[model samples]
Target: MIRTPASRRHGFSLVELMVSVVIGLLALLFALRMVGGAEQTRRSALGGSDEMQNGMVALFSLGNDARSAGYGLNDPIIAGCNTQFSDTKGYQLAPATRGTTDVTPLAPVVIEAHGANPDRVTFYAGTSIGGTPTLRLTSDAAAGATQFDVDRIVYGFNQGDVLVVAPEQPGGDCLLVQRSDSDPTATRVTVAADAGMRFNGGTPTATFKGYAARVFDLGPVGSLAFRSWSVADGYLQLQATGPDDASAQPSTVAEDIVSIKAQYGFDTRTGSAFQPQNGLQVNQWSAAMIDADGSGTAGDAADWQHIAAVRLAVVARSKAVERPAAGAACTTTTAQPVVFADAAPVGVAAVPTTVNVAVTGDPVDWRCYRYRAFETVVTLRNAGWRPNP
Candidate 1:
C-alpha cells in the first residue's frame, strides 16, 4: 500500500481515536439525561391532572345528592323521624346511631362523623310528580294494614310509588311502604305485600300505627333516591337504595379519593343556646348534630331540623409512584395535604378543625405521591322551603 501523507491521512491514530470515543460517549450521556428529565416532568403533569379530575368528580357527586336531600321528607312532622324501612332484597337505609341507640332518621342529609377518618354522608329525597303533600289519613291505620285511606283521591301516585306513613307527632318512627295498587279516582291506596314489591315485607305493621298518621308520597320506585356516600379502599363510593338497586353494594364514584370530611351547617344564631335564625343563611357548623332543642338525646329530630346545608371536603392522591434517588428517602410529599383552608368559624369563636388524612396504610408508600383537596358547601334547598317547627 502507498503511504499517505501526514496532512492527507485517511485513518486516525490511537490517541485521536480515544478522544473521539470519549466525545461520542459524552454526547450519548447528555441525550439520555435530557430524555430522563422529560419523562419525569411528563409523569408529574399527568399525575396532577388525574388528581384534579378525580377530585372534581367526587365533589360533583356529593353536591348533587346533597342538593336534593329531604325532597319529600322535608315535612316538619316527619323530617327527622327515625325511619323504619326495609327491603326484602337485602337493602336497608344508612344505619345511624346516637350514643348506643341505632337509628335511621329521615332527613335531607345526615352526616356520620369519624374523627381523623373519612366521614359518611347519607341523602334522602323523593321524585314525586306532584309536590310533597302530607295527606291526612281518613281513618286509623291499624298495625299491619295493607291499605291507607287518604282524605283526597290519589291522582298522581303510581303503582310503585313509595309512601311514608308518619305519625302526627314530630319524633316517631316513620314506616316506608310501597303502593302496589292505586286507582286515580279512589282514596284507598294499597301497599299490599306483592311479590314484586321490595319495601313492604320486612317492616312489621306494629312498627307504624295510628289514626293521625299522614301519607307522604315518594314517587315511583325508580325515581326515589336514598344514597349514602363514603370513602373506602382509596375510592369514593355511593350506596343507593331502590327497587333496581336492591343489592345495596357501594359503587365506586371516583378513584384515588383518600379522605372525605363533612360538617352540618346549621341555621342558628350565635349564642350559648342554639336559637333558630331567619332566612336560609348558615350561622354555624358542627361535625355532629347535638341535642339542640334540649331534648336530652343527641341527633334527634330536633337536632336534624337545624341542618341547613352540608360542607364537604374530598382528598385525592396522584397515581404516579415516584422513586427516590439511590438511598435517599421519599421527598415528593413533604407534608400532608390541608383541607377546608377557608373554613373559619362563623358567629362565635370556636376551635379550628383539622383532618388527618390516613394515606400510608396502602401497599405502596403514599409518600411517593402528591395529593389535592376539593371542598364545597351544598345548601339544602328543600330545608329552606320548609318552615322550622
Candidate 2:
C-alpha cells in the first residue's frame, strides 16, 4: 500500500477567490478612466492649435494685399469702382478706367454686410513697384498695330499681360492693351485684344517722350488680383480673380472663422503735427469716421484715401463639440466681444467688436464649445505713398 501522504492541499476558499477577483477589476476600471482623460486633453490642444493657425493665415493674406494696394499705378489716389473693361463681365485682359470718375470720388476699399454675422471687404491694389514703371518706345506703333517696340523688356511678363501707355504730361493720351506673346526675350509683345481702348487713337504725339512711345506693364492681364474676403458657412473664404470674372468662384482660406470686424484708421488732425484737436495722439479709428476733403464733413468717397491702416479682428471656434461635467448643464453664461486696443471711434456709440456667433445645423449644443479671438492692425503702405490733394 503506497503511503498516501495526506496531500496538504489548502486550496483558496471561495470567499477569498471572489474578493481577489473584485480588487483586480477595480484597478482595471481606474486605469481606463485615466487613459480616457488624457486622450481628451490631447484632442483639445490639437484643435486649439489648428484654429489659431487658420486665423493667422487669413490675416496674413489680407494684409499682404492691403499693403500693396497702389503698387504700380502712378496715381497717389486709389479709386474703387466698376472698371470700364470689367463692365462687359469677364476677367480684365486690358486696362480699365474707374467707373465712378477720372478723378475724385474714388474708393479703394469697400465694406459690405455691415453689422451682420459675416462682413465682406473688398480692396484694389496694383503689383507695380512704384511711380515711373514705364519703358521707352523703340519705334512708332501704327494704329491697330499688333505689336510695338520697347527699349527695355522686363522679365516675369507673360502672355495675356496688360500694358498701359499714358502721357507723361497727364493729358488724355492713354492706351490699354493685352499682351499676346509668351516670349520673355522678345523685344515686343503683340496685343490680340484692345478692349476698345487706344492711346491717342494710335497716333504718336510729339510731346510724348520715348524712342517711339513710352509704355508700362501693369502686371499680367491675369495679375490684377481682385480679392474679396468673407465668412461663409463657418469658413473664411477668399474670392480672387479678375473682378469681372463672374465665373470664378471663391476658395477657402481658413476654417472655423465665425465672425470678423474691421475699422478704418484715419488722420483727422488739421494741423501740421500728427496730434488731433481732440487731444488724442492719433485720431481714433471708426467704421463711420470720414474726412475726404478734411473740410470737417465726412462720408465722401475721397475719405477712403485717408485710411492709413485697418484694425481687424477674427473669431474662431472649435470643430469638435464638448460636454460639461457629468452632471453640469450645457449653458454658457458669458459671451464677450473682442476688445480692440488701437480703435477709438469718435462720435460713435461703440466700436464694432466681434461677438459670440451662433452655430447652426447641429444637434449638439454650441454653448459647450470653445472659441478664440485674434486681433491686429495692418498698415497700408501704399496709402501713405499717396499725397493728400
Candidate 3:
C-alpha cells in the first residue's frame, strides 16, 4: 500500500474519538470529588476547635466565681469590704428554689455619702412579650430627683462591701450610698443603693461586678443566699446554698458547683501543744491568727479589731458538657475526666478529662473540682482582729 503519502492520510475513527471524550469526563469528575471532600474535612476541623475553646471559657468562668464561695463576714474581701448590713436590703427575688425573702444588708464600710445610686432591678410576673419573660422595676433604688419616689427598694450586693438600700434622698432623684467601712451615718448607719444606677456606674455607687453578690440571711435555700452559715461541731462553718452546692445531691445541675473552699486562721497556742486535727486554737491568740506564730483566738466579733484572720478557699467548676464517644482507634485508652486528686500535678487547673472506657453506659467525661483546692492564711492581727500588740 505504498500509495502517495499525502493521499493516504490516517486519523482516529469516530468511535475512537467518542471513547476519548468519555475518559476525559471521568477524570474531571474524580478531581471534583476530591476537592469537595477536602473542603468538608476543613470545616469539620474548625468546628471541633470552636467547641473546645467555648468549653474552656465556660469552665474558667465557673471556677472564678466558685472559688469565692463561703468567704463569710470575716473571710478575705479581696475586692470589697465585709460590711454587715445594719438593716437594709440589696437583692430580693423568688429563687429557682427557696422558702424566704433573700436580703443583703448594709455594712459600716461606707463607700460614699452623696455621689451616685445603684440600679434597682425587679423581676416578677408579667406578660410573655416576644416569647420572653417581661418584668420592670416600679421602684427606683437610687433616684435623686426632687420628689423621692418609689416604695421599698430591696438589694443584695457583693458579699463583703457596704451596700445601702434606702429611700431616694429626700428631694434629689439620686439616692445616698456608702461602700467603705468608714461610713459617716452614725445615727442611721444605713447604706442605700438608689436602685437608679448601673452596677458598674463610674462612681462609688456601683457594687456588683460581672455578677451580683448573694447576701441572703436566711435558711439553707434563699435567692439572696450566696452562702449559708451553720454550726457543725461548735465551729462556725459556712457553705454555699443556692449556687454553691457542689456535692451533687439528688442530681447534679449544670456545673451545679461553681466553686467552694475554706481556710482556718488560729491564735497563738495557749494551753497545750497544738495538734493539726483538733481545730483552730484562738483562746489567747497571738498578734496573728492561725497560729502562724502558734497562738489562739484573741479577737472578738463586737469590735472588728477583736479577732484575727481565718482560713479561706474557693471551689469552682463549670456545668457538665455533653460527652462524645471513642472508637476502635482508641482501644487501650482510658475514658474519664482526671482531677488533681487523681495523679494530677499541683496548681493544675484543667477542664473535664475524657478516657476511653468504651463501655456501654459509663460516663466518659469526668468533673473537675468546683473549687480549686488551695488554702491561704490571712492575718487580721492589727486591722481585722483585736489589738495584737
Candidate 4:
C-alpha cells in the first residue's frame, strides 16, 4: 500500500463536531416544546368535555324529577301543609318553615335559598293513578291512632301505600303514614307500626290530630317521589325519602357540580277577591314566593300554587387545576360564573344571579378551574290539574 499524504486524508474538525452537537440539542428542544404544548391542549380539551358531561347530567336529572312534581299532590288542601312523617330507616325531610316558626307549607316544589351559596330544592309528588281524590275521614283520628275510618270503603289503596292525612285547611300540619293493611271493601285503613315497613315504626316528632281530615293517597310506598337536590363537596347530591331507595343517606348524582340556583316562575294574575287565577303565563320570577295576593304573608299556599314553572341553573367546574407561571396569577378562570344571564322572558320580571365557587380549606384556588353553566325552564304541567281548594 502506497503511503497517502496526511493533508489528503480529511476528517471532521473540532469546530464541525461542536456545531453538529449544537444542532442536535436545538432539535431536541423544539421537539420537547411541541410535546409540552400538545399535552396542555389535550388536558384542556378533556377538562372541558368532562365539565360539559357533568353539567348536562345534572340538568337532566333535576328536570326529570321536577316535571313529576305534584303528580298525586295536586290537592289544594294539602299543597302547602307542613307534613310530619316517621321513618325507621333514618330517613328525614327538611321541615317546611317560613321564618323561625314551623309554618312551612308543603308544596310540590320548595326552594331554600342560601344567598351566594348553592340552593337546595325539594320536590314532592305521588304515583297514585286515582288522581288525588280526597277520602274524607268520617271520624276524628286521635293522637297515636293507628287506623283511619273513612266515609267509604278504600278501593284503590294497597298495602304499603303512603297516605297524607291532611286537615281541611291548607296551612295545618299533616301526617304521612304507610298503610300496613289494605282491604278493598273495608271502611277502615290501618297504618300500624308493623314489621317490614320502614316508614311506619318510628315515633313522629309531633302528634297528629286529624279531625274532619282528608286522606290523600300517594300510591305505594316504593313509588312515592320525595327528593331533595343540593350541592355539597363539589358534587350534586340527592336525598330521597321514598322507600324504594336503597339508603336514606344522600347519594352523589354528579361530580364537579359547584353550585345550583333556582327560581320559581309565578303567575301573579288574580281574579275577584284576590284569588289566584292560576294562569299559564308566568309573570314573575323569584327565588322565594312573594305576597302575590297582598295577603301580608309570603310563601303561603296560594303563592306555592301559583308557581307555574321552575327555572334552574347548575354550574360545573373542571376537575384539573390549571397552574400559572411562577409568581403569576392563574388565567384559567377570571370571573365567577353567572346564571340567568339573559333578559327574562318577554313578560317575566327577574334579574341575573351570580354563583360563588370558593370553597373553604381547599388547597387550590377556585379561580384556577374552568366552569360551565347549564340552565333550563321546566313547566309544571301538573299545576294546571290541581284541584280547587
Give the number of the best model, judged by lDDT: 4
Q: Show model 1 residue runs off by greater than 4 Å.
A: 1-10, 205-210, 242-246, 269-278, 344-361, 387-389
lDDT of 4 by residue, 297-375 (tens): 7766666777888899999998778889999888888988889866557656566888998765678888899999999
TM-score of 3: 0.30
Provide the RMSD of all predictions against the true structure, rounded to 1 decimal: 3.0, 8.4, 18.1, 2.5
The true-structure Cα RMSD of candidate 2 reads 8.4
Instruction: Tell me each candidate's TM-score.
Output: 0.89, 0.65, 0.30, 0.92
lDDT tens per residue, model 1, 50-79: 999999999998989988888878778887
lDDT of 3: 0.27
- Model 1 RMSD in angstroms: 3.0
Tell me which of candidates 1 and 2 scores higher on lDDT. Answer: 1
Q: What does the lDDT come to for candidate 2?
A: 0.56
The reply for model 4, stretches above 4 Å from the true place, is 1-10, 202-211, 243-246, 271-278
State which candidate, 1 or 2, has the greater TM-score: 1
Better candidate by lDDT, 2 or 4:
4
- Residues 235-274 of candidate 2 have per-residue lDDT tens digits of 8877655534433456777888877766676765554553
Colliding residue pairs in candidate 2:
80-107, 161-221
The lDDT-based order of candidates, best leading, equals 4, 1, 2, 3
Cα lDDT listed for each candidate: 0.78, 0.56, 0.27, 0.79
Which regions of candidate 2 deviate over 4 angstroms? 1-10, 72-108, 129-217, 242-247, 270-282, 288-298, 325-328, 331-333, 341-352, 387-389
